[model samples]
Target: MAVALQTLVAEAERYLASAKIHDYCPNGLQVEGRAQVRRIVSGVTASQALLDAAVEADADLILVHHGYFWKGENPCITGMKRRRLSTLLSHDISLLAFHLPLDVHPEVGNNVQLARLLDITVEGPLDPTDARVVGLLGSLPEPLSPRDFARRVHEALGREPLLVEGEQMIRRVGWCTGGGQGYIDQAIAAGVDLFISGEASEQTFHSARENGISFIAAGHHATERYGVQALGDYLARRFAVEHLFIDCPNPV
Candidate 1:
């Protein structure tokens, strides 16, 4: 089965409500390929490994959370950029990416998906006052020690998270997927007992310690692996096109 590339992109844009949310990169249809798409390959990032896997799978379109043409990236498609762009152009594989939209979406968003995997009951946005922070507030079914919570995260994500244990048990929680260390303060202000993000800055440790809040820095790739897969499944069900999620693992 196959669907028109335009139709799929339109559905994704509409479903994600991408135009309503501002992002660091352009959302939807980064590179154009075939008019009709029979298979879609989804991943956390559009790294060379993912692209090579997509090529091997003979994917018609590549869907990802990370894409090209960022807000401050150099425009010249020279080194790695040239290789990636050439791969797509040579293979005629379309590229579709969504950034912030995929993070905060009510359905199939990274935060919400991670909540399900970690058994957190989502309460609301981490910072309702700040639209810039794409974090969520949630609670565990029961209060668990910081170490126990970290173990749960490790088991779920298949990666050991860096835990900065606070002086309290963890019940109320907050998290943002992918390099969201900047939002730790916002999460603290939200009054969560613990905060989780993909990366941590040097200052994050002091903030967590001083504020008596637990902190976890799960790998960025590890935390964001679910949303794209959910989105791909949605598209597959909607359009009857084949979907594949290739996890080109990243330690960072």
Candidate 2:
């Protein structure tokens, strides 16, 4: 039994509403397509290649982490943008996107999933005041050597982590999945011994050294790919819709 497009969209939208996220792009149903969705495809970005793949799969809808109409994007429908949207519109494929909402959903969020994989117990949001804190602070079940924890992260995530060890053991850690290096200060203020994010900047080294917080930079796209995938699986099982996750490599 397939789910109606309206129903699925409503579920996703309601989920977003509950989170109260501040999103750069709109949260749900960026493009309208068939009224009924039997097959759904999800990916990290709505790139030209991903749209083509969705079309090939005869996907009724495309779910992505990064959708169109970003804050700084030109409103005009030009080269790359035109190509991506035109393909979906022509195919009558609906587009549903959840950015920060997907990152902080607690049950299906990227950060939550990453923490679960690393066996970290979430204490609270790194930024308590912000309702949509993308990062979380947590403590390890048992204290592990920094090197051992690094190896565990690499093995679980299937990618080598960039590690900067601090002076103390990492019992309490902070993590924000995908390009959240800017939150290192907040993590430090939260008194987490280690800060982990998907991407690293040159200045992050100084932040780690001076702040005395251990830092780890996992791959941005790699860390984030799980949340949307988990959401897709959940929807598929709950609503009996077929789903596929399209993978596109993003090294940064």
Q: lDDT winner among the candidates?
A: 1
Q: Give residue 122's error in model 1 in angstroms.
A: 0.5
lDDT of 1: 0.94
User: Per-prediction TM-score, please?
Assistant: 0.99, 0.94
Worst 10 residues of 1 by lDDT: 125-134
Q: Model 1, which residues run further than 4 Å from truth?
A: none
Q: Give a tens-digit lDDT track for model 1, residues 1-252.
A: 999999999999999999999788999999999999999999999988899999999999999999999998899989999999999999999999999999998889999999999999999988888788899999999999999999999999999999999988999999999899889889888889999999999999999999999999998999999999999999999999999999998999
List clashing residue pairs in candidate 1. Answer: none
Best by TM-score: 1
